[model samples]
Target chain A: MSFDGLWPYIYIAIAGWLATDLWRWAGVVAGNRIDERSEVLNWVRAVATALVAAVIAKLIVFPTGTLEASPLWLRLGAVAFGGLCFFIGGRFRQIAGIAAAIAFLAAGLALLGV
Target chain B: MTAPPESQSQSHWFLLGMRGIFSLPAIILMLSFVGFAAFTAEAKVPVEQVMFMTGMVWALPAKVILVGSMLSGAHIATAFLAVTLSSVRMMPMVAALIPEIRDRRTPTWLLLIVSHFVAITAWVFAMEKVRDVPRGGRVAFFAGFGVTLTLTNIVLVGLVYGAVSEFPPIVSGCLFFLTPVYFLTSIWISARHRVIYWALGIGLALGTIFAVVAPEYDILLAGVVGGTAAWWGERALRRREAAR
Candidate 1:
């Protein structure tokens, strides 16, 4: 409620987002004529994809927020269930499976009072 | 390939879908930030400042470090340094995207504006689809995409701040589940190379192990070790293939 209390979050948000913008600008500036299929783009795609993957894995394995409280088995089950759904539903159906896995896990946890 | 005017329309819609889905993710991601702000608000971290940073910094990890360091009583300089260390990942990200945007001479002004909201999520989606857009149209598409996400995130933060209790830990936990679920799905759907499969295995193994041992540097350490191992593994595979 206090103005003083609000400032830190604001500062963090601005600085964090802006620092990243610097690169997008650089990409636009430098991307003037490069081929998308070239080795560089492929590496970028691979690494970026890899990082996003790593982030997802980290969250499942060591979640911070609400997830931190959920039992480890539930988290792993949700991921594995989601993985199964992903494989079963094909590409688009996988999104729903993710939601379902989480929902199921959460419901089970709630029922068990864990 | 130049995206024809009509294809551009379709692609625009596609980008819009990508942007809109971010709202769903933002609904969850913002909760942690809002919760952190609300929890720490009495301690002097600005809510507006946090909201503004969420918009400006767009990247969650850096934003967390910047404010977390400051909250810990670290000076702005230290906060900046820590955030910058995390920002190092963006260098390789930029190196990869620049060449893809080649061919279109987007005006300097628009690039400046679009750059502000470019985050890992948008970059991944854009990289996949940018090739379909001609060099010139990429900016507009990216602009439209970035703007959509920026507006959504701001609204999301505001909502999270206002409705903090509605999304209790259970809801928050469920929401947080989206990141991993989404990424895992994307990898399963798109990964083609054996190298990628190996990289993922190594990254997950090392990342999980190191995460427990050294929570602070897990991502960076896993990335470096796993990435290098994957690279070498692929090289070795290629050599064997050639020899055969």
Candidate 2:
């Protein structure tokens, strides 16, 4: 909130900006050499998706802050609920899945008296 | 992926890209931001920094990692390294995506500039829809969606940041869940190969184990190992099928 406070924000901004964008820059550099349909390209796609999957899994399994308040089973339950709705919900599958995940999380939380 | 038509005007492509804001993914992504705002407020981080991170960093995962590390009292350098490793997945993704949308004449600088906006949501959105967009217009269309999504969420987070204190912890938790769930389902649905399933499963299992072993590097290690294993595993399966 003051002049002294501004340093952390500046450091965070720099770290956040560079940390995220570094990969984008790297992707463009690496992208130029990759044959679009090659096995290597498929590997790249696999790696990206897998990494994101890892991140999601980590979050769900060992969350920080408020999400850490809920039990891991309850968290996975919500995701499973969402996944189920996603498959069967037809045209608005994403909406159903997301809405279901939230609703399930809320219900689980309520049941635990949180 | 069809025949390339004559280039449309830049504005046309831009608006077409902006139109994605109303789509299911974008709506869910926005809700994800609403959760971030709420989550950060509860953790007592500066609202201005969170907003700055939303616009400047522009990736929810990176922002979350930054705040999560700070809350846990991590060294700044460790947080930076963790965030960088997390974003490394962008390499294969942007590589896979940019070639699909750019023409030979598309400028490198423009591609570099706009590529900053090509996070997971925008990448999936563009990959699904850009097949029909003419080659000349694909960049604009991608930019329209990516840039607009960033700006929209930045503003959305800013607006919600101040009001998040009133929200219950459960509400914020559920709101935050939207982004990851959206990412999970959309990526699984849009995956180009069956081998991706292998990667997803391995990544999840290994990620949980690695979380306790080396929390800072868990995502990077699990992803690389899992993905490489999937590729090799699928290849062996194919060879066995051929032999049979």
Candidate 3:
């Protein structure tokens, strides 16, 4: 890549650093002053939890790349099957559940001949 | 239960922490990073730049967004905005986690440095394991775990980037699936509050609905609206219980 092409990486590094690290530094400073049970902390936790969920949902619902080629039913089915495996394996078997989902997706793809 | 004596040296505590993450947690994180390495290779990002991002950026989702947006011809500012918005979730995680491992005597500079290590994997592992370490040892423990994770990523990303050409697209795609699936499973496993469960379910539904109807801002909208709904629902339930 040329020098101009490299400019984008530098920009991404600086901009991405500011975007993410600002929160971490702010949290460290503010964490020193706040009690865990404070309402503000609770709200922050709520928002964070929801944001992570939203990210996961977006991945499943609006995935990019080859995963996006699968039908919606297949995608949703993989998640549901994974959830079921999670529960059936006594809820602590996370890797097992994920493996099951992967297996389901592979098998479904094969059966569909897609 | 009796508290463990807080007499361990910082190095000792750090070694213990390293040992703790040397197992399943580290394996999971390594696999995730390898997946990300494959992803960067597929995106045609340079190996050196990928390593730089892995070291500096650290957060997978933001890194993914940065690469995805930039590859799609997004302007630098637009890519930055997308990555930043996606990563706003880490703030609460850091806020909640630092308090658990910190004390009045903890150095502000140290706290600032360690905060960079407070990603989802480290945070979850630390929350579960830090309680067992003595008070003074907690920070060292987290630092060790965090540093190990980073080093592992650096090494694995290098290896995967070189070998990515040998893997089929389907194999690489399945590996990519591990990232989001792992996040989803971890959240479900770690969440102790019923309200958070409600938030996740509602968020998933709303995210899907919005992705179809308004794909551009689906995640942001789902997070704000679904989280607010879950918070309100939990508060109402708490009030009813108190009244009863």
Candidate 4:
């Protein structure tokens, strides 16, 4: 079989796959050389956490996809409710928080439909 | 490096990690994905292409970025840069997690391989759970969660790709809300330092502001600028406390 025009898939691979994986490989290489308990590792951890926090905020404030259909208050309010349960759940914090969010969100959406 | 007490404890880490398949984080991820199919379906991207991306790109945000840029008819170079910027958070995630997973016995090659699975959900879950796990088992534990998550989401996306648009908007909206809920709490609870609190607050404030002003580079600017500010801000505080 001869290789024909497949620039779209080729473009997908280069842009989609390589772009994302580049950081993972870099992280490993950088992580390998550092002392485990070093302050530098702490800083890197901080950066990662902040980056994800940005993602979470963006999802709530300016979401894409179907979530964008719901009112922004419903979105932010569910997280607030979830965060409350997370702090209160103690041992099962993650589960409690997520369950609370879904319960609150689904309920709010249903109520809004009425 | 792990504490002395934890390292001495021996357990079947692979089984422990693999057990993450049943965890809430895993379930919530599936829930978030149920509504994700519409984006790809709307784009008229083939199911096979979505499957291909699910395996190769792995990160949900990165996949969204790719499909989004394509929808806008962006150049390959722009998409490349966007995806790269979007996934930049994965770097520190891998960097921080590898040290935790590597005992003196864990190999570099193994860490490199598992690094591919370090998406936001998996990384946050492993970071939270691995504290109680043995260092020798941390890698297995994380790999179990990461690999399980990736495979499960791939299958979930495939099943939903053809079935998404029929769902009501409210239902889809609520289902997709699981991610931000799970993410915010997990990220808050998993932070190892108070500086992370600073980072979170600053990141959120700046993320919101930037989304309004500079939509294209919001996450990038907020993440880098907010993260760095929190980092140095905390350091300077520590220096002052030490001087007293």
TM-score of chain B of each: 0.76, 0.86, 0.85, 0.89
- lDDT tens string, model 2, B88-169? 7777778878778778887778888988998778987887788878878889999999988999998888888888778877
DockQ of each: 0.43, 0.62, 0.58, 0.54
Candidate 4 pairs with clashing backbones: none
Off by over 4 Å in 1: A1-41, B1-45, B107-113, B192-194, B242-244
- List CA RMSD, all candidates: 4.5, 3.2, 3.1, 4.2
TM-score of chain A of 3: 0.82
True contacts kept of each: 0.43, 0.70, 0.58, 0.71
lDDT, candidate 2, at B215: 79
Local distance difference test, each candidate: 0.62, 0.80, 0.76, 0.81
Identify the leading candidate in terms of TM-score: 2
Error of 3 at A31 (Å): 2.9
Please provide, for model 1 over A1-114, each residue's C-alpha lDDT reduced to its tens digit, 9 standing for 90 to 100.
233655555445444554566655665555544466665444444555455556667777877756666678888887777767766775456566767687777886687665
* Candidate with better lDDT, 1 vs 3: 3
lDDT of 1 by residue, B1-244 (tens): 5877755564675475456454434344444456544443434554566567767777766766766776677765566667766665565565555565434444667555666666666666565667667665566666667677666766666665644545555665665566667656555544555666666777777778877887767666776667667767676878899999
Per-candidate TM vs. native?
Answer: 0.79, 0.89, 0.88, 0.88
Report the number of the highest-DockQ candidate.
2
